[model samples]
Target: MLNGHEEQEGVNKFEEKDGNSKNYDESDATVDRHRKILHTDNLKLQDEYQRLQQQNNKLQLLLAEYFQRKKCESRFSDECTDEEKERCYHNTLAKLKELQEECVDQKAHFEDQLKKLQEERQKTEDMVETELEIFVVYKREILLQTMKRHGGKRVSLEDLDRLQQVEERREKELARVQLENIKLNMRFSKYQEKFKAHSIGVDGQHLIDYEELKMENHTYNEKIEEQKEALQKVKKKISSTTHTLTQVKEKLEFIKAENLVKRGSLMKLEAHVNEKKEALKNLKQSRDSLWLDVKCLRCKSGLLRNVDLLQDFEDHCDSNDALKEKLDYLKMRYVQLTQNCREFRRKVQYAKQT
Candidate 1:
């Protein structure tokens, strides 16, 4: 009877341990399932973020294109024909209307999406809080059962440490997830603000009165006609100026060639004057020697016999007069050349300024 009781007690303890182990396994499985669901939610959020970013980029591009088109239309308004301008204006109006409609649709869709996200966030929060509470209660029950089985002895230090560590990790993870959700909400709000701004800009155009736009259009047409007339006059003036410029260019080229020839002639004249000066120096020296010879002859024989000396003196005087005239002519020519150079330079400068 004593052996049987001991066996029964051992079996009961074994069964209790088995039940505890099974409960732990089930709890672990539940935690793993919750983790998987959270992971999926994170992935979905990431995908949504990427999608929103892409949409934002596309919207920015469209807005930029719209502004560029508007600028181009404004620039060409005066240049375009009346019919073309009207067509462009109609097209722009049509596009604006379409964009307004699209904005309305997008706004509605975004509002719906926002509402859905809010509801989903609330549901997720509620579910997570409930699950956490349940998990805590389960843990407490397990701890109590463990203590009972151990006869109220202190729980193992390693198990207590592990439980504390797991709870800390879970709390940290929950905080991180909450932070992420808050950040996502902030981003959504920013997107909403942007949408509001866009809608306001689109609607602002409606404030302009139609009568005022018509009057402005009429004034623009009158201005365009005036501008066209001015442009035609400018074109005529440009053509006349171009013809004058071509003629001046031709004259400048001719003057440059003539100046080159004149410079060559001036160079030749200078060389000739140098040669003449050298000849005059030689003639003076010869005359002086001849005079000395005549004086010596007169002193020795009391008379001079050479008649060529007087003739040579006469010829030297004539040559000196000719050289003086030639030098004066060269000086006049140099002055004329310099004046012509100045006049040509002035004309070239005037042409360039024009």
Candidate 2:
């Protein structure tokens, strides 16, 4: 019977050794798997770091280009013609487009990385859960042993202190992350508001330009009508001049007939008296003075017509100058309005961020 008990004891010892070997094998395998995962995480982190470095380099380059453009624009602002200004705006628009595309790409990349990281975190958590379960069972056994030895005492003081420290650390990390998120949200809101105000200002400026153009068109139509009226007045003046010329010709013909008859009479009277000859010469001189008066009237009428035309031209020039001044004022106002809108937008964005 003693040998039988000894043999049973030996069998029990061997079974215990087998159980320990199985536990050690599982523990080693789990540890190896965790190590492999950690190595993979390290490699991924390195790759991400390199990508971030590249992005930073690109950002720096973009900033440098922006500064260069600004400098160039500042130097040229006073001298820039309409076409040059347009070219500068076009270049800026193109750059904005490129930036938008880059932002989209970066957003996509970040989302993808986030997804990958979440998946890895989930897997890691699962592994941790399994390990924790094993540890919990081991700890339960140890706790039971400790309770038995110490008459139901609780956990060690050191362990409690460590747990409190861990909790505090986690709380701090969460708070930090939340604060960062709040800041980002605020900034995003600010930017959005700024963009809205800018857009509204642009719309308002466009409306003003449209109104100005309509007014300009109306003024041009009025000018055209005035020009037509002036042309009609000129035509009327020409017709009156033609009629006067015809009357002058008729008067000249009549004077010639009268002179011929008078001369014949004078020839008959010449045999009677020299006094009658002096009276005939005086009448011829009066006829010559009357012709000079007619010529002077025609010259005076031509000078009046020229003066009227010149006055009309001066009036048109004055109107043009007034229109140009109004246009310049409108343009200046539009620019100011746009600037104000931009500032409003920036403020709104800042408010939203806050």
Number of the top lDDT candidate: 1
Candidate 1: C-alpha RMSD after superposition: 52.1
Per-candidate RMSD, Å: 52.1, 66.0
Give the alpha-carbon lDDT of every model: 0.62, 0.60
In the range 1-354, model 1's lDDT, one tens digit per residue, is 124345345445444554565665576567667656765665565556556655655566577768787788778767768898679779977987887788678767866776776677666656666766666665554444343333343554455445556556655655554555555544554544444444444545423433444455566556556655655655565566457446644654464455456556666777898999999999999999999998887878632455687678779999999999999999999999999999999999999999
Query: What would the TM-score be for candidate 2 when compared with the true structure?
Result: 0.34
lDDT of 2 by residue, 49-72 (tens): 445545555565556667777887
Q: Considering summed lDDT, which 10 consecutive residues are worst modelled in model 1?
A: 144-153
TM-scores of the candidates are 0.36, 0.34
Model 1 per-residue lDDT at 17: 52
